[model samples]
Target: MTTSVSAIVIIVLALTALGYILGRQRALAVSDREKTKLHSLPGYYGQTVALYVAVPAFLLLGVWLFVQPIAIESQISSDIPQSIVDQSGAKSLVMADVRRIANGLDLLVGSGGFTETDLANMRADFSNVRSRLASVGVALGSDVQPAVFEAAKSYRNIGKAGSLIRNIAVLVTALALGAWSWFRITPRMRARNTSETFIKSLLMGSSLIAILTTLGIIGSLLFESIHFFRIYPARDFFFSATWNPQFRGGSDLGILPLLWGTLYVSFVALALAVPLGLMIAIYLAEYAGSSLRSFAKPAIEMLAGIPTIVYGLFALITVGPFIRDWIAQPTGLGSSSSSVMTAGLVMGIMLIPFISSLSDDIINAVPQSMRDGSYGLGATQSETIRKVIMPAALPGIVGAFLLAASRAIGETMIVVMGAGASARLSVNPFEAMTTVTVKIVSQLTGDTEFASPETLVAFALGLTLFVFTLGLNIIALYIVRKYREQYE
Candidate 1:
């Protein structure tokens, strides 16, 4: 089976290479008589042919790979006994065993532990099939049933036939398409236009894939969120202050406390990040000398490269304890190490590079003429930066802040370790609280069924988070657009 897959891949590549060579040779042969008579260059012809050969073969391979398993499974699933299927509550588990046994048999044959004839003659009742399978590292649940074992053998035979057909079909498609393109190569051929059209379509398809993926995520969220709201009242979910999710049902799943925690932490983070990040950006872009800027910028940006988990660890071990002892304990605010202040401060540090780097680039993009005009009006360097450059770069700086805010709201690890998982509505920054993400994780991590409101609330939370971020982005875009229009 591995050999068949590999052989198909190798043959596709080989045909592609052959097509390139033949195409190039044919183009050269036609153009050798008079190069000026050719419609396009020889290279264009080769690229066109190669793409034609490779793309269709790869497309066929993809479709076959996706469809073959489904077809084989459908046929094999029907052959599985109804008794076994009903016992497992589905045929999937039985099919899984069949697949495992089939794979084990293949391995046994490949390893020379068994012959084809030996496997063909063997029956489930005649031998210790389970022990034999376990020796080959294929452990099955309970003793293998006779019906399941027979189905496994059928699954193996049918799968082999499907693979053989797939291999031949793919290779033939590649070679046939390659040969057709080869014969069609002529001096007047519009190979360049054809190739470029195909490339343009590919680019459009890639863009569409991204758009469709986003839509898919939104659709799933909306569908599940609706399901959740149906079982649990929408008014209570959105309006209530409590967020107590009980696995046994009759739980209070409210978004207010989680929203408060999220906004409070994000607000604290932005308060820290905006001023410091903007100052850093201003200094790096305008005040810092070239030598200092070169070293300092990368060093500052390095903070962005560090994992958030590492930052969470820092908060848990250092920041949280320091704040609890030096500030919270001293002031009699709160005793716990995990608090809103701990997570916010660490998240702020994590967001610094995102703000600073993006803001720096935006500040640098401010036209030199704006500063020159300010200087001509008798404004000092600092005055010019403050009056002219800052105004011009304000839109982009706001965009950076919005991005950092989104990052802060969606953060998980830092909130879990630094801000303990307690959903509450409180004004004290030193008190422990959790965000929507934390609750989403808690609600979905266990063995809860999708039909339960407890589990389904994760989707509602996710949808809420998505809408919040989307609203922020839309506001940022509106402000930026308005500012850009005024500036231009």
Candidate 2:
């Protein structure tokens, strides 16, 4: 089954690639005008067709793949004797054991221990099932008794005979569309419309990947969170912000302080990363010579490549104590190894690469013509970069900053390792503070009971993080769309 499915996947890939190439060639070949020739290139047309073929086919295969085993097993279980199947916990165990035996190509005497006869019978059964499924699938284009196979593959075979047909509906559609488009590409054909539509859809589809991935992540989190919320009240989780999600009953799991910690640490981290990163961007883009830029840019980017856990360990071993003794101890703050300042500062350093790299890219993207114009107008280099370049890059900078902020808010390792797990709603940077992420890590790891408030609280934290970041990204994108300068 796996090998057969793998072959199907390979065929889909090959077909998609072929469709794409053919569509693009057809578009290019059909175009008549030179300048106002195409609103989009041939590649877009090809990609659009490829998407049409791949998405539907893949979805069908995935659905069929998921349901086939379940339906088969369910049917097999039903047919087995009641004496063998009737018992508490027996059904699950029996199903598991049966699946194992089948998977191993082993068989049992009516769900009992395997015999030589059982093995032969199992082989026969497998072969029979495979042939029946293959027959049903041969020409079945769309509907499968979803109770049996969810969604059938697109290739419809001949209906007259019960056995099989090589359904090539997708291939046929591709060929037909390709041929029609090719034939229509005359001096009068509006190639631009066809090309532009294809490009627009391809862009939209690419953009949807981020949205869908975000949705999928949040959806999974929401389901788990809903389960959590069922076991606990929403009000208590949100308002009781002082979180002590120890395995104790009636512990305070207030979200407010956890939220407070997240905000405070993020504020400090941003305060540290943003200004420093901007300065680094300025130094590299304006002040630094070519040699300096070469050495510095990658070296700075390498900061991002460092593992967060390594940074976490650094915070634990070095930064925590160094701060405790140098600032926290002398300033009358508690001498705790884990403090908000420690987490915040380390997090800020981690974010430096993110901010600097994005800022650098945006800065470089600002047209050098703008700089020459500024220079011609008697503006100093610094003045040009400050006024013209930075302003032009503002939208991109804002987007990058928001993305970084999201990262900071979502960061767990540094906070878990460095920030004290006490969910205190304190503004004092020297004092220990714990963020929502810290609580999530603490609660979810180790042996956990799903029903307990401690465990359930993690999902609530996740949802809050999700909503907050989602809102920020949405707003940031809106700003970029409306106000950001486009240098054509």
**CA lDDT, every prediction?**
0.88, 0.71
Evaluated at residue 165, the lDDT of candidate 2 is 17
- In the range 256-301, model 1's lDDT, one tens digit per residue, is 9999999998998889988999999999999999999999999999
TM per prediction: 0.84, 0.63
Error of 1 at 14 (Å): 3.3
Write one digit per residue (lDDT tens) for candidate 2, span 1-488. Answer: 44555766788788778877876776666563443365565666666566666766665565555655566556555655554445422554444444433333321222355454533333223354454334433222222221122111100111111111112443354445545554544434544565567658768978998998888988889988888778777788787756666576767777899889999999989999999998898788878899999999999999899999999999999999999998888988878889888999999999999999888888888888999999999999889987999999889888888889999999989998889788787778888888888788778776555557787778888899889988888887887788777787
Q: What is the C-alpha RMSD of each candidate to the true structure, in Å?
A: 3.8, 10.5
